[model samples]
Target: MYNKKSREQLLKEYQKETFLRKTVSFYKYCTIKNPQEYRDSLYQSFEQLNIFGRIYVANEGINAQISVPENTFELFLSTINQDPILQAIQLKFAVEDGLSFLKLKVIVKKEIVAYGIKSHEYDMNHTGKHLTPVEYNQSIQEKDSVIVDMRNYYESEVGRFQNAITPDAHFSKELLPMVANQLAGQEDKKIHLYCTGGIRCEKASAYLIQKGFKEVYQLGGGIIQYAQDQKKYGFKSQFIGKNFVFDDRMSERITEHVLAHCHQCGTKADSHKNCANQTCHLLFIQCENCAQNYQDCCSKSCQEFVCLPKEEQLKNREFENKRLTSLKLSTKFRPKLKGLQKNAV
Candidate 1:
C-alpha cells in the first residue's frame, strides 16, 4: 500500500518533481460484478506506477481524473488496457497540463454520476454519436443545431461555448431532468452536448435518445480532447474561458478570456476553491485578496475555529461529538455561505 503523508508534504514533493506530467480523465458506465475487488486491484497497480488522482468505482461504473508523469503515461495506459473491464474504455486526453491532482484516492460510491434514476432509464448499448472536435464544431454551424453544456452552474460560469444553453442545475441529480425539460419541445432538433470529460454526456445522450430526441451527438472526448485537437489541426477553439475541474488545481484556462467573477470580490477571476476549513469545505471562488484576508475559511465561524489553539480545538470537537451522541443530533456538515453574518456583511 502507498504510505500516506501530510497534504503539505505531498504538495512540496509534487512541486519538486522535475518531469512534466499529463492530466487524463475518463469514465465507463457498465455493471460491476465486484466493486471492491476491482478497486483494490486497480489501486495496487496504479500505486506501483506512482499514478496519482481521484478515482470512483461503483456498481454502475467507474470514473477517473488522474495525472501521470509523461514518461510513464504510456505504461499507465497499457496497464489499464490489460484489465478486461477497462480494456476498451475510451480515455479523454487533456488539452494542456493543468497539474490537476496531487494524490491518488480511490473511493467506492453508490453511483458514479448520482443521477438517482432507476436502472431502466438508460440503456448503455445505445448512446449518441461521438463526434470529434472538427465534426462537433462543423455541426454547430448547421442552422438547426442546438449545443448544450452538461455541467453544473458553477462549472459553466467559468467557461463554455459561445451561445451554448447552460442548464441551471446545482447538482448531477438535477441535471438530467432540467436538461430534458429545457429541450422538451425541441426533440427533433440536432442536439450537440458536452461536459468536462465526456462521461456524463455519454450517459446523458443515451437518456436523451431514449427520450425521443431525433439527432443526438456529443463531443467525443469533451472539452479536454477538443482543446488538444484544436492545437493539432490549427482550428480555432469554439469554447471560451476556463474548464472547471475537481482537484487541488480547480481549473484549466482554455483561453485568455476571463468570463467569470470571484464570489468574494466580484473580480474577473474564474478560479474555484474549497474552504480550507476541513469541517466547512464549501466550494467557492475567491480572489487572491479575499483568500489572504479570510485565511481561506468560508465564514467567521470557521475562521475562529481554525484560529483556536490545537488543544482548544480538540476540546470543542470532543464536545461537539458528545452533543451529537447525547442529543442524537445529526453530525453532517453543511456548507455555509460567506456573507451570512452581519459582521461579515
Candidate 2:
C-alpha cells in the first residue's frame, strides 16, 4: 500500500471524499521513553482511521491537533485511550470545524510548547493551579490580581481577557523573561495566565511559581474551552474580540468586540491577513476596505512587487531586502508603538 503522497494529491483526494470530519485538539506533558516509536505508532493508528492534522511528540509528552471523521471519532478516541499515557485525555473541539488541516503530520520535538526555558528550571509536576472558566473569571476580578496573556502579541492583539497584561514580545523565546520582568515586583499578586490553548500556560505558570509568585492560575484548556463553557453554562464572556488561531480560519470569534485596528489605515478591525506577496508574507491586520485598496499587501511596495513577473519579483527581493533592513522590517507594522516595558521578574 502507498502510505505517502504529495500534499496536493492528498488534499485533492480528500476533496473527493464525502465523509464529514471533526477537528479535535488536545495535549499532555509527561515522560515519554521513546518519542519516535510512539510517534510512528500513533501515526499508523490514526492513518488507518483517515485522521488528518498536526501532532508533535517530545520526550516530555505529546501535543496533538487532529481532525477525525465523524464516523471514526469514537474509535479514534478509544484507540488513543488504549495507550495508558493518553487515556481519558480531555479533547477540545474547534468552534468552527471543516477541513482545518490538509494532511496528517506527527512530528517529534524536544518540547511541546517551545517556551525555550531549561527543563530543569521548572517542574511540570509543580505547575500552577488549573482553574475553570468561572473560577478564572472571578480570580481576575480580585484585588491585586494580575492576568498575563501567554501568547504572542499578534495572537493577543485580536482577542484577550479584560485587564490582561499582554507582553510585546514577537517570539516565543522572549516570552518568559519578558513576562517575568513585567511581573517582577508583583510577586505576591495573584497571577492569572492563559493562551490560545492551555499548553503555553502549563510551563508559564510553573515558571512563575519558581520565581516566587505566591499564587498562580491558568485558564483550564485556554480560550477554546472558555468559549465553549461560556456558551454551555450561559455565563458572560469577559474575553473580547477574536481568538487568533493557527489554522486556515486565522481566528475564532469569541465575542462581538473588535479590539484591534487595521495596520495600514488604523480602522477598527481585528481580522489578520498575510501579505499577498508570497516572499513577503508578513502577517498583519487589514480591514475589508483596506484589504481591497492595498490588494492584501502589508505595504504599497509589497503590493507592487506581487504584481510583477516571477523573474522580476525574485530580482526585486534582493533590492527590497536592502531597503527594508532587518530592524525596520521587523517593526514595520508598529513604527510608533511605545517601547516594551522593562521590568524584572
Best prediction by lDDT: 2
- Per-residue lDDT, model 1, residue 124, is 73
lDDT score at residue 336, model 1, on the 0-100 scale: 28
Q: lDDT per model, in order?
A: 0.79, 0.83
lDDT of 1 at 136: 97
lDDT of each residue in 1-345, candidate 1, tens digit only: 445898889889989999888877888888888898889898999887888888888898899888888888788889988988789787777665767777888777887876766768888798999999999989998999999999877788889999899997666777888999999999999999999888888889988998999899999888888888887898888899988777656677888988888776789877777677654556677788878888986556667777988878787986644543443233222322222111110
lDDT of 2 by residue, 197-234 (tens): 79889999898888889899999999999998888998
User: Model 1, stretches more than 4 Å misplaced?
Assistant: 1-3, 15-18, 315-345
Cand. 1 TM to true fold: 0.85
Q: In angstroms, give how far residue 263 of model 1 lies from its true place.
A: 1.4
Model 2 spans with C-alpha error above 4 angstroms: 1-11, 311-345
Please give the range of 10 consecutive residues that has the lowest summed lDDT in model 1: 336-345
lDDT of 2 at 318: 83
